[model samples]
Target: MTRPIAGWLSDMDGVLVHENQALPGAAEFIRALRDHGRPFLILTNNSIYTPRDLRARLSATGLDVPEDAIWTSALATAQFLTDQEPGGSAYVIGEAGLTTALDEAGYTLTAAEPDFVVLGETRTYSFEAITQAIRLIQGGARFIATNPDVTGPSADGDLPATGAVAAMITAATRREPYFVGKPNPMMIRSALNRIDAHSETTVMVGDRMDTDVVSGIEAGLRTFLVLTGSTRREDIARFPFRPSEIVDSIADLVDRVGTPA
Candidate 1:
């Protein structure tokens, strides 16, 4: 028989912290996981910041996760492209984080006749850039997107995410880009491989049913939905996907697992 999960794969934004604030019980729950020696990894779709940068930001908010324990779509995208073509070139329509990741992975960043067109979140997503990406894709370049999140949580409220930009490119090119973040099995597989964990022995925790819950289910892991960000109680009924469990916040997770201290 399968045992209760000995590890967890958690979403960063909505499940643990919302914006700059750590959600209720997030810190204590993390402490519990540490005390119990249960392995957990932070899997995030946000590609705007590096894992090290995100670790510092979360630490500043009192959610002490290690730099190496964090995995972002940016990193996964880099790994995927690197593995696909060891010394490939890419035309990136994204921010510093994505560019840095691709650069570190030995990908040449260019705008002309690249091997692939990479889409991620950018503060300055100009029409000119979109046109450029479309031209490249139409000219037979492969397309890859960091994540498929339509909106991102910000202090100013929800803003269009990288997926929105990807949609535009998809519309123009008539070809769907390969997604590398949540709701895609590639990310889960990468995380599991990194941690040396199995799907049956792992749990996925997040806020969104469509992304987090579905991803977990597809990966054959237990899924927990927290009502802290992106997803609300009312939205649960409308979501086509379902989680194995639903809690008010990460704090409630501690109460449920009661992992030995």
Candidate 2:
């Protein structure tokens, strides 16, 4: 087996839980890692909630993750916008979480003649909103998005995510968005910087080959693909990207690492 990783970066939705419910062995795996003193952080493309808000929700679900240990696309997006256009006004197409993050980062969210057009997942997306966003982009607003995840797991089923909205805007305005979430090295860099982990010693654990695996490869970290979410065994042959390790789930991660702590 390969050497055990020194640090870990994991995706949340498909790897650990689905629809607010913790998956089998997820908590145990995390506890084992914690008991062994391994440093790990949850990296998620979902920008619907801040780290603190997610932490509370996870805690309520019995996950016991700390606020600082959670990294969301929202935080990364906020940071990216703040760096690119500090204190600039933006027309936001997302949820309360996206707005709150931008507010916290000192960005001015607006609806009219904004300097930038930021897009994310919205449950209430309407035709009028899309038309307005298209107009804004055409009228010289910078296009930005949290991530390119096409869909998210919901209780009812997979629902359109921020990527869908981003795609619509891209198609309408004929402009590509500056993405700030997973598969982008910026998110990985932010996580690594926060935990002070070297790329050589870090392992990225997630379920998707296109996003998680690709992101890890780009970030120069070992990648582990879990079969608990998006990628399935039958779909492996169809995947263009590859991971360094493949496991049944995060539950089996401890076994792959060797004897349990």
Q: State TM-scores per candidate.
A: 0.92, 0.89
Tens digits of per-residue lDDT, candidate 1, 1-261, equal 656778888998888887688988989888877777777799888788888889889998898888878988898899999889998999998887798999999999998789999999866788998999999999999999999988876678878888888888888889899999988978887888778898888988998888888988998888889988778888999977788888888887885445421
lDDT of each: 0.86, 0.84
lDDT of 1: 0.86
- Residue-level lDDT tens digits of model 2 in 122-221: 7788888889989999999999898998887767988988888788888988999989898898899888877888888888998988889889999998
lDDT for 189 in candidate 2 is 80
Error of 2 at 194 (Å): 2.1
Candidate 1 lDDT score at position 229: 79
Look at candidate 1 and tell me the lDDT of residue 156. Answer: 85
